[model samples]
Target: MTMKPYRSMLFVPGHKGAWADKGVNSGTDALILDLEDSVPPVEKVAARDVVAETIDRLTGQGVRPDLWVRVNPEETGLMNGDLEAVVRPGLAGLFLAKIYNETDVVRLDAVLSHIERLRGLDDGHVKLLACFETAEAMGSCEKIVAASGRMVSALGATGPNADAGRSLGIEFTLEGLETLYMRSRVNLALRQIGLIHPMAGVWQDLANLDGLRTFCEDSRRLGYRGLVAIHPSHVAVANEVYGPDPEEVATARRLIAVYNEAEAAGSSAVDFEGQHIDIAHVKTAQALVDLAEAIEAGS
Candidate 1:
């Protein structure tokens, strides 16, 4: 799989057009112009127009960050119109929220394909990322990933943050442990369908750098490729968190060089820096080296 590091997916409120510029300058790999949770209800229409205008201006100004637009949920009357305004060539992808099933994802793909065809652009060229919230959606994670096909690549799941806090009569803090489990389930489900590495979720509290760092490390350990951040200040941390350490890279290179020499000598296993090495060792070393290269390439 081609790795894409969604280390920092910063959210910019749709109404704050100025923040669009500020968001790009913040060095986030991607910015989400949120028409969902970030915008007030009454300002939806105005915000929609503002987001479209801001996107065009950003493109004109050569901002060129990964521009992802988070549309309101399908139940919201604004989804269709919001998408119509924002899904241009300048947009890198769509951050679809409240996706409850495979059908939701398929419908989104169809819509984007239709838009692209109407514009005389190639069909299925747009990228889509779906958010899983409900317990039902969590249960159907494999189906959702399968239904996405080539158009859908990333899957994000929020437990208490989106579902439990709003639905299951649970407190946010009380649901943290469950949220981690929920996230792990989704991550495993995605891997089953070959999307082994994908962006995790928004942690919400941008100022909690310590907590953020801890969570970032946790995500890395949990097989997550990267994470989503809601603030610009968190970008550098995200970028740094999901990569092979310099020491690890050096060790990987050493392992590979020694292993190669041993293999040329017809040895089944080799000793490297007083440590025994075998096929498994070489495989692990190669993976680390690849990760280091990906990080350097800003993947």
Candidate 2:
């Protein structure tokens, strides 16, 4: 089944089952119950069951926000266990971490297919979201996203002081000039496959809502449709930043109207509120309007 793009994907420690509800209550568009870095090694096994149950608990007929789980990396010898435990009916997708290249996604796709069959799910029912953490993954992002039809979403995930920054040996900045090229490439990869709603990474400063907003704004300007949030407090900021404001949507509608009027009068383009409006501008405006409608329908 196809899913909507999540505006705010908030991470919750899988072992901390109680926090899942708290995260949902924070108004996140999706809940990523994690069994990866957030969970201690000793509790890794247990967290799988916790996340599975959490999915079962929160998911129901007509559930609004979807549930996604971030399983451990294949190298840890724990991904199989993680998938076996949580690939139940309620799971919307799997966030595959430490992805290196297209081969990794292909292998996981096969495994997920097998699990879906076992769980009585339709083939390709469970989608995959790629998390570009390592340098290899970042560089081969285009191939990875294009590798699998089940690859529903892909994120560049270049958070400061985190796996990406450490792996790429780039310093994080609020202006994001250091990873601008990397981000631009990833954004291009996303657009190459028509996955316009690409998501971006963690904002480490949990208490700094302003910083979070800045990071989200940077992503928005760079063409990201959503964000991967670490803390519940960041959910609102992510939603607000990535989502279209009323005025923006209204402007898009007006642009569409003006373009239609110009075309009816046999003009290919015209001045739209002092800005040139053409087919290209109408298309862009239509996209914003479409996104606004999708968000409204989902809400």
Candidate 3:
């Protein structure tokens, strides 16, 4: 699987085209043009057009970050119209909101296939980032993620008082201990299905930068490769937490060097920085170095 580095996916209101450029400049790895909750009921149709135009404009301007649109749920009659308007060139994928089951993914795959054929785009060119919001969706997380080859990542595991919280009736807390079970289950399912970089949902408290940092750090520790940032201030925090630390990169390089020397000397194991170094350790070190390099190159 080709992994895209999405350390920070910033949400931008589709109705506000001006915010698109601001989101791009905010240093987010990707921008999610939100047409579901952010756009008012009366402005949905206009927002789609605005989002499409902004996508075209961003691509024309040679923006580096991938652009994704968070379309309304499949149950909404507006999903088809939103897809039709935004499936043009420069759209990276769709952030499927409020997905309930594998059936939703299958239906979306079929729709995307039809759109690709009509638009002359390559098959499976438009990826999917499924949002598991409801209790039903979370229960079938594994099946939902495996349902579509176009699905690149999953989200909505921890959004408080939103789709997930409201669906589960869980209250919001900064500690996030309440949603640990759900988050861990979702993360394990994603990993089991080979979706290594599934996104942890947004941190709603905009005033708490420290809390956001702690959340990102905790998410990273739990094997989340990225996060959805509701504010630009959280972008840097996410990137910093998700990206490899300088000390870690240095240690990885040293580990690689020591392991290589040990291997060349006809030994399978060695001592490095008071830790037992072996093939498995070396492989982990190499992956860390590679990730660090990829982040650096992208930056």
**TM-scores for every candidate against the unseen true structure:** 0.88, 0.94, 0.97
User: Model 2, stretches more than 4 Å misplaced?
Assistant: 1-3, 61-63
Residue ranges of candidate 3 with Cα displaced over 4 Å: none
Q: What C-alpha lDDT, on a 0 to 100 scale, does residue 296 get in candidate 1? A: 61
Best by lDDT: 3
- Kindly give the stretch of ten consecutive residues in candidate 2 with the minimal lDDT sum: 57-66
lDDT of each: 0.75, 0.87, 0.88
Q: Per-residue lDDT of 1-299 in model 1, one digit per residue for the tens?
A: 33355667788999999998778887777788999887889898889889888878887877646788899988887788887888776777788777788888888778878888776667655677767766667677778877866434454444344663564444555235646766687777777776756776667775888877887887777777777778888888887887678998899998999889889999979889999889899999898897677656653
Which scores higher on TM-score, 1 or 2? 2
Regarding lDDT, does 1 or 3 come out ahead?
A: 3
Task: Flag clash pairs in model 1.
Answer: 5-299
**Which has the higher lDDT value, candidate number 1 or candidate number 2?**
2
lDDT of 3 by residue, 1-299 (tens): 45587899999999999998889889999999999999999999999999999999999998978999999886889999999999988999989888889998999899999999899999998999888889999999889988988888886557766778888898878778888888888888888877778788689888899999888888888888898988888898888889888999899999999888989999999999899989999888888888888877777
Q: What's the best-to-worst order under lDDT?
A: 3, 2, 1
lDDT of 2 by residue, 201-291 (tens): 8888889898888888988888888988899899899998888989989999998988898899999989999997789988888888988
lDDT of 1 at 35: 92
